[model samples]
Target: MISLQEENDLIDQILGGKQEAYARLVDNYKSYAYTIALKILNNRPEAEEAAQDGFIKAYQYLKSFNRKARFSTWLYRIIFNTAISYKRKNRVQMESIEHNDRGEESRESDLERSDKEVFIARAMEHLNEADRLAIQLYYIKEFSLDEVAEMMGQRVNTLKVRVHRARQRLADELTKILKEEALTL
Candidate 1:
């Protein structure tokens, strides 16, 4: 925890508007801030955004920082909160793009989506690397079940179970979240 005296000193310097001091603050806190943001947003671009946003917010709220807590702890919470908001905003945008439009064109044209694979990276973070690889191979990369089995070094039946279980777990989690939200509303 930064002492009241230290915090006061930093705030005095910041309030005096030492741009270099502010940059030093950001540099000091950025790694942990970015990690917290990434855990929520899971997208590099969004993580970067949340980290940057958190820094700006920290600058704006510097005076409000509690001396009892570590400066990094307060900054971490802000970064986390910002990342959650960023994720929520992005989920809506992704859903919009995911919807099938009624006026679809040729199959080849249908294959060309405006939203890129970057969105999938965020969803993939919900799974472990193994589950993520299985999902990518089965869905995104278009590998056959046998190929997936070979890649995973598991029996075909085992691979099938893993895929099925992964899908079920994801659906169950989403359903639970939706139900909780519906109750809140």
Candidate 2:
């Protein structure tokens, strides 16, 4: 991780016409940017494209970046917005299929895990976009609420409420699904 001082220096160099300095910033934040994009788009190719596009946009507007916020917070907001735009533009849904090969004992465990994942995913579908994004960022990605709120452009309290409500909805949905499955069995 780059120190805030080092990050500021790099920004200074980039603004002073040292293009290579920007590469360091991209390298430092690319994974995070890609992860954000992936969470939003749920497609590898689209996420990669969105992350790259976000970096380009950041660079294009680098001159206008005020020093009030950490560079990452600002960049992530841009990446989040870019990924959301991509999601809006590409409305097609793609489902991923996974195949697991393991020892017999592990196979059963994997199957259980996979089943739970399916249930959770199905529950997630019932959430509004903001609630879903809040849950994913806060729980799955392990971002602090402050960071998630900043990246999502919401007040911290608003994000907390969304996360809480999302969790409640997910739990209710999962319970309903599990009970239905139990009856079928």
Candidate 3:
């Protein structure tokens, strides 16, 4: 993790005409940005595009960034919003597990992995975007609740409620999916 002082120095350097300093920020946050984009866009190519565009946007608006928030939180908000915009403009179709008709063409391990992925994806689909993002930011990305709240522009108490409800919704969805799978078998 980049120290706060180091990040502040880099920000200052970037603001002072040192464009290369921005690359360090990108290096630090790109994976998380990509993950955020991927979860929202659900398409690798579009997610990559969104994440790159987010980094570009962040650099363009670097001078306006408020110092009170952690840089990762700020960058994450940009990436998340950019991905949502991309999703809106493109209206990408959600890839359903039903589309995987590859019967016996796959190996057992691959099938199991694909099934788990499908299960999680389908479960996530049941959630509203905010709830889904809250869960991802808190659990999958392992951000602190306080950080997630900041990124989401919500109070910590509100965020706790949101996360709890989102988890319950996910669990319900997973149970439903499991029942459907059992019936098929």
Candidate 4:
């Protein structure tokens, strides 16, 4: 964990005209930020674009950051909103394009991973967006319920319920996917 004092120092440096200091902050949070965006958007390229846009927005708005909250919490809210907006914009763009108009350039690369990892990713897609993000923030990023609530602008109890239901839904989806896989095998 970065000490609060160190984070404050970095923020102070960024605010004091050392623009390069912001890169340190970006490096520190980029992985988690990308994961959050990917969970929301379910597309690698768009998620990357959204994460980058979120960092840009965060840098632009740094002067307004409230020190009372954790920087991660504040930054994640921006990422979540940016990814949601990206998803909506992409949805619209997709609707306007003829199916044949989508070129091969937009295709995702076939990166290899474990079957279980792939299954988990698919199961996450089965979840409602809120539940998916709740699971990701609580389990994947290991943020506290209160922290997640603060980031999502929701009550802690509501997030707790969302997480519980998300877990159950994930379990069900995993079961079904595994069975289907077995049949194919």
Could you say which candidate leads in lDDT? Answer: 2
Off by over 4 Å in 2: 92-113, 140-142, 181-185
- What would the TM-scores of all predictions be? 0.49, 0.81, 0.80, 0.83
lDDT of 4 by residue, 25-117 (tens): 999899989988887776688899999999999999999999998898899999988988898878867665525544442232214657787
Clashing pairs in 1: none
lDDT string for model 1 (78-175, tens) is 77567767877888885665455322422334366432332333344477655654554466233467755653456888878778877776666556
**Which residue pairs collide in model 3, if any?**
none
Judged by whole-model lDDT over C-alpha atoms, candidate 2 comes out at 0.87
Q: Which lDDT value does model 2 have at 110?
A: 51
RMSD, each candidate, Å? 15.7, 5.6, 4.2, 3.1
Lowest lDDT block of 10, candidate 2: 93-102
Error of 3 at 134 (Å): 2.1
